[model samples]
Target: MVEPNFSSGRAAERPDAAVGSAPLAEPAAGAAIDPSKEPEGRKETKHLSRSRLIWRRYWRSAGGKIGLVGLAVILLLALIGPSLALWDYWVVDDNAFLSMPSGDHWFGTNQGGFDVFAMTVEGLRKSLVIGFAVAAIVEILAALIGASAAYFGKKVGMVLQWITDLLLVVPSFLIIAIISQHTAGSKSSTWLLIILLAAFSWMISARVIRAMTLSLVNLDYVTAAKFMSVPSLVVIVKHVIPNVASYLIIDFTLGVVGAIMSETTLSFFGFGVQKPETSLGTLLGDGMASATTSPWIFLFPAGVLVVLLLCVNFVGDALRDAIDPSSKSGGAA
Candidate 1:
């Protein structure tokens, strides 16, 4: 330093020696930076699960909302209409036979003097019960058979496929009619009808489920689960079915309609829900005979039936569109 070292002089004269830290350019005037804000492209949003997303899309659709409302009204009627009736469904007023809609009998009386309003509500409840029962049983059977066949493949798959094919070709209506005719008056008739409907209904759905399961079976996650020593049943229950749940749900909805129609047809033909135990079908059958004479008998129940089916179809369509990402009809608003 005393000798005026050149390196020290150079360092002292350097710009870096004059400043304690590197300088950064100041932002332009009025261009403030906020740490709380993120770039639009990098902004994060909350994630929703598949079911919640589907539900959101479904409720947003006009048809879905209408359908849901209609169904709720129908269900409310089915549940409470009987209790509100002035007379019980079984109560017959000989003087009120075929009476027109009056304050005493809101929906009038049938030929047998049974309260049409009460009977109609009872029939709706029974029909709904049968439809739900058949649909649930069919779906369970289809899921089990279809998933098992796809997962096992080989001989097991072939046998199941053959059975399914055979059943598909069989005349389900005729077979059901015949079986139901024989079991008509039995104590277990309702259960028998449910089983028969489920038995025939499952074959078609099983085939569809099998195809879907086959596609899922070879997926990486499924394969990984298998490799990790997970049980086949567990993998199928946990992975396979969940992946195909959308299809199952739609199928179940349609199945309910189908089952209800089937029961109605059979009952109309005297092969289901035998006498004394009325269903919508039985009411319909009775109404047809005197339709022209007493239009109320046919009009009210038929109206309810039409409404039920329409609502169900609407709901099913909405569900299909909502659950399927490829669908454009029920896109989020």
Candidate 2:
């Protein structure tokens, strides 16, 4: 409220002493409105977010865009190319396999007459299948074994870790060589080799899980969980697995690549996949023998395998950067 002295005419008429009446003052212009003074109906304006946000920042980064696009294109090819094969190129002698890269037979046929292109597509699928399977098995088994050892600690942990290290250091090729060849006459040869590979391959994942579990075991949440008398399995799953999942994911990708390479090396040495069922490595081996005369056989299969491996590896690298602490600051942004 404003107060004004009105001591002139009105006051005189009222028989009070005649003085002066003062006019009310106006507020200064361009004054800021206080938040407390604002009316209930009026709303403040807000800035908008930028439009088309998905590719905005991505388009600016050359490496990231290249890697991402390459990965996408390669994955699509790996997925769709094999399924849409022009002919059944994976098995046996066919006229198409002998044919050169043309509209009719895409990639030329092998000496025995299997289409290189078709074989390549099928090979990619098979390789991916085995790779993923091995990765999953290794990561899960290793994580379980590793966490248990680390949590238990002492001699048990030391002995298991030692065994893990022993397996980890052995050349994958040499180990695969000995096992695959020795187990060649088994009832289920390919399955046996895959199992053997899985058996020996958990070391790295074990190491990763152990390191993570070691840290988690000392955490306050874990301590509290223990105090609450929670089931060990439940606590491990609820607390430990979630924290280590990112590591498992990254390692799984790598494990896939390793599995592919291991399978290839074994096949090339004439120990894996056998004669009737062919893999990219088997195809490469066949092509290698005739490479001097029939370069297409080796060329296409090898090329596809190389591309597949490269794409998988790049993606794995990017994922690792995205997840791993040491690599996150330089992650695929």
Candidate 3:
């Protein structure tokens, strides 16, 4: 205590020492942050909109990539395939009856001398059209009926629910089969078939939509819209349906597959898609008789149908996983 501390005194007197000992100044309000020094999980981030986020997750999925590519290729084939064929689907090649695949007649000719390639392309196009049409109708009907039922509960809800329940228990396939058979000869039979398929297919989906709407109708935004004197239809369409759009999208994908299968079944049994207009099912039915004698007829159309259905299933699975935050199959967002 009696002796002076030279080092301590020097340290106190030294400007460099004082500088070293002083606390660091705070960063300016608008200074650029050094990314390297940022703490984990505190780095600057960009926000993603719901659509973008869903697309990001879906694109990251292996199934989604495969499905999308496969679908695109199939669509391309459907659009331009007929032009590539040597003969029209219904045109008979008198000389090349029941022939195997060749340079002139790719995919061979059936018993009727019709080009297999051309028939397959036509069938694919028709099936796709019907599938998309039916799916659209089903989604629209389900959304409107289900959302309306949930929003206007009590008498209207009960009636809608009753209708849904009735449809659920009814033999839809039998009803559709009977109706399609009766209308098979009409000029608008194809459209009629699509409508029939859509009518029966939406019941289960409507129930699901109703359940979703019940949860959504009381949300703050929905309530606000209602209080603002917005029309009921406008509120349901703008607010309620959008909230359930993910499910609707997934349902639409699956619905396409189902509609195609249904149409195929009906056509195979001669109840749907009458002659002069062919479908995959009709081709399969015609080919079944010659399967053993000529496998090409059965194989080509069968292959296309399998591929289309598989792609649809993959897309549906990917969509479901992408939409569900709890699902891990879509990988990290």
Candidate 4:
């Protein structure tokens, strides 16, 4: 203090006294820094799984949001509408025959005096069940057959391809009609119909999946798995299937619509879900006879079917867009 430590002060004041250590200059007042604009080395990294990313993109789209809401409403109605109905679907009320929409009969009455509302709800439930069952079965078959053929790529592949080609060439509608007719009166006709629809429906999806799998089989991860001696089935299930899951999801959704349409067409022609077990097809078939005289009968079921298919197709389209990186509708991550 006596000498004011002039040497030390001078040393501290020297510009390069600390060598590489330099004081960081404070940013100018009110000058905010954007973290997102930081250099690559300083930028924060975010990791999202494939499914989460798909969902994020899907929900961000207007069509996806609308379709999801519509589908949910339809499902909710199918599940709970029956419980809220005033009359039983099977219990005939002769007094209410050919009734118009009233507080008691929300959707009016059929010629048989059954509650149209109750029947519609029941039919919706059955149709949804059949559609989902068929779609799930078809997707499973497509994935298994496609992945196996692509992964094996030899006699096994050829045999599977041959089967797929043969099935594709066969008149699926005729075969399904014939088989369903025989099983229509059986107790498990619904299950039988699901199986029949699934069997014929998978060929196209299988071919598409096969083509995708072929490309994936030569990828680095697949090659690594092969080098590791991982089982073929394991690789197909764990690695191959996941890579092409977006396509499978879209196909499954479309499959549900196709199955429902097929079932409806079969029922309309008297080859599908027979009496005692109602379906949308059965409802539509019965309604078609006196559609002009009793418009409600035809209009309600037909309207529901149209809406259901539209919702499903919309959802499928949105999912496709969301999953495809090249789609403009997918927007940002």
Residues 128-186, model 3: lDDT tens digits: 99999999999999999999999997899999999989988898778878888777767
TM of each candidate vs. truth: 0.86, 0.73, 0.89, 0.86
What would you estimate as the lDDT of candidate 1?
A: 0.89
Query: How well does candidate 4 match the true structure in TM-score terms?
Result: 0.86
Off by over 4 Å in 2: 1-68, 71-75, 90-97, 169-175, 178-188, 324-333
Error of 2 at 3 (Å): 32
Query: Which one wins on TM-score?
Result: 3
lDDT of each: 0.89, 0.73, 0.92, 0.89
- Candidate 2 lDDT over 160-182, as tens digits, reads 88888888777876766767776
lDDT of 1 by residue, 31-93 (tens): 977746758877667799877898998988898999989999999998888878899998999
Residues 183-230, model 4: lDDT tens digits: 766799999888888888999999999988998889999999999999
- The TM-score of candidate 3 is 0.89
| Whole-model lDDT, model 3 | 0.92
Clashes of each: 0, 7, 0, 0
Better of 1 and 2 by lDDT: 1
User: Judged by lDDT, which candidate is best?
Assistant: 3
